[model samples]
Target: MKKQHFLVKQMPPEEIELEKKRAELSILEDDLALKELDLTTLQVVLEDLRRRYLRIVGVKLAQLDGIEAQIAEIIARLDPKNEEVKKEADRRRTQAQESADATGSIAAEEYEAEPFKPSEDLKQLYRDLAKKVHPDLAPDEQARERRHRFMQEVNQAYSERNEDRLRSLLNEWENRPDSVSGEGTGAELIRIIRQIARVHNRIEAISQEVENLKESELYKLKMRVDETQDESRNLLVEMAAEIDGQIEAAIARLKNISQRVEKTERSRTKQRDSKR
Candidate 1:
């Protein structure tokens, strides 16, 4: 066989630099997608825990508040002439009603019907959609706003574990006018550079948000509850039980106050009859 020579064309410096920037942009996009997904997942989990906490512990707290209000009402009735007592009773009643309304609004089985656990396929789709349509990747403020709205729906679908909706959103983005890209090595490089900056800013924002979430009081309590779960201790149930004890004590106090108010009324009636 005869030896043969083949030539390889060297790319221009600008072209080479553009290629490098493109590679960097690709990697950043991937990182941004993953980070956004993680942040969304954390938010969904925390929100679920919030609902569970309201349902379990908050309801009992509301009940206890109601009993306290009852006690306050009885005390006020025993001294009808005291404005302070009547005002305190009204305040307690209002507080109890608000707490009851707040707790009652959380559905008892809202999350139990279907867990928010996303399958691997669902996660993959979400990551793809996030990378393709992230608002920071938009070229202008108007485009960014549009992307923001679209991404909201995407995030909602992902949180709900709606794979079909996510797939539909991906298709919708592909067909959207903004999905088109312009070409020209120099101009493309400028665009890519701007994109890189935007993506970096977005990634940092996601990090800050995730940190804030982790530092929240609710998140701390959730972590403690999870830690106790590993040790076979149901902290939420225990919390509810603790509240139940308080509720029982409050009920007893309310009963005692009610009995006192009745006895006072009976004695006053007897005195009025004797005077007549």
Candidate 2:
């Protein structure tokens, strides 16, 4: 067998070192790819959950808020001198209307389709592109910003599940002049070291973001909703039904309050007429 020294002698020391760093950078890029994928997937799932929750439970809650606001306004009218109650009534009415407007803005088509599920090919292609073009792998600030722009398109294509768009982007990147880099071996090695440091920082940032997302109340609710889904039960629908109950109760209270106010106003008018 050939000697280990012979293998070392096959290339200049700096060249060999450069190759080693390139390999390390490639591995780190792959790691960053997976982390980014996880973050994107979580974002997509959470967004879907949010829209569904708003459509179901949020609208009903808005309705309840509106009825309660009506009740508050009637109460405020009965005690016209109570500025605090009037202010509270106005605030509730504004909030209820805003909530109703927000609920109305969600497009019906957004949640009508089946859930997002990328194909194996699409996922692999995204990972490959991320490894090749992730901003964190850039050797300079300018290159990093350029890579960031390209990566945004890449991410958008991936999120939209447009394989054709991703392929087009890959082709465009390959044709770009900046895709190629060159320098003295020592300089290149230094660049690679800096890039590796940046990649580490980015990876840590992504981990922190993921942790924050997981800890959020919205995410916790999403997890509970998902669990209920697995059990063939619809948590959002159930929540909406509960809200519906509350809304009906609020409506009854509003009706009762309005009738009481009307009866009191009629009695006052009759007493004034009797005096006249």
Candidate 3:
């Protein structure tokens, strides 16, 4: 046989383009993931603060309640018309309860149904994401760890209805260098195209989440609280201190009322005057 010359052709522009995309997407995914972690941590902290604020407020209110009742009772004995104060307080309390019942409750809110029910769409999305990033599918231990973290985030985002996050993750992982290569089969190319569409969906979801979080009341409150800080004191610490002061003031008021009550315990003249 005669010696023959052979030639290898360079990859087409389309295949080259796909290879470039995989590199760019991996970098972008890393950036988005760090951002995701920050937002998630903020959200978790905000929720915990909100719950703590309500619980502390409840404790303070309960402490003040006994003092308030004592004051009202004493005032009513001293002046019969003060009974109206208790009636008015009752009416306002009822109105407040009705208003809260009309809206969703975050704290002291009772629910008749499950608080978090995954939508059918959400469940479907979650299934897709889980399959895409399942740790067992990773080719090596390092890849396995990465996928494991991705799956954790996927589970969290799914639980929290962060569909943008879930879809984004699906798009992000599909572009993984190992998963998508210039030499990928036709089936893989089709999957990549579908994932590109999912990335578009992810962008929209992220935009919505940004708007929603910025508009959230808790976010606003947190911003305000953050402004009231020094090296030694934080917002929650200051609030606790204020509550303690109020509780002390309430006890003093209760003691003053009790003293007056004792002083007048034998005064029939004050009783007759109250009746008049």
Question: What TM-score, over all chains together, does every model reach?
Answer: 0.87, 0.89, 0.50
lDDT to native, each model: 0.88, 0.85, 0.61
- lDDT per residue for candidate 3 within 20-73, as digits (tens), equals 666655554444444444344455556655655555454455455545655666
Residue 112's lDDT within candidate 3 is 25
RMSD of every prediction: 3.3, 3.4, 11.3
Clashing residue pairs, backbone N/CA/C < 3 A, model 1 = none
User: Candidate 3 local accuracy as lDDT?
Assistant: 0.61
For 80-126, candidate 1 gives per-residue lDDT tens digits of 99999999999999999998988877954554533256799988998
Question: Can you list the residue pairs that collide in candidate 2?
Answer: none
- Model 2 residue runs over 4 Å out of place are 1-10, 107-110, 179-182
Q: What are the per-model numbers of colliding residue pairs?
A: 0, 0, 0
Q: Lowest-lDDT window of 10 residues in candidate 1?
A: 107-116
Deviation in Å, model 1, residue 208 alpha carbon: 1.3
Highest TM-score: which candidate?
2
List the lowest-lDDT window of 10 residues for candidate 3: 107-116
State how far residue 139 of model 2 sits from its true place (Å).
2.8
Candidate 2: tens digits of C-alpha lDDT, residues 29-123: 88999898888777877777777777888888788888888888888999999999999999999988988887887744556444566788888
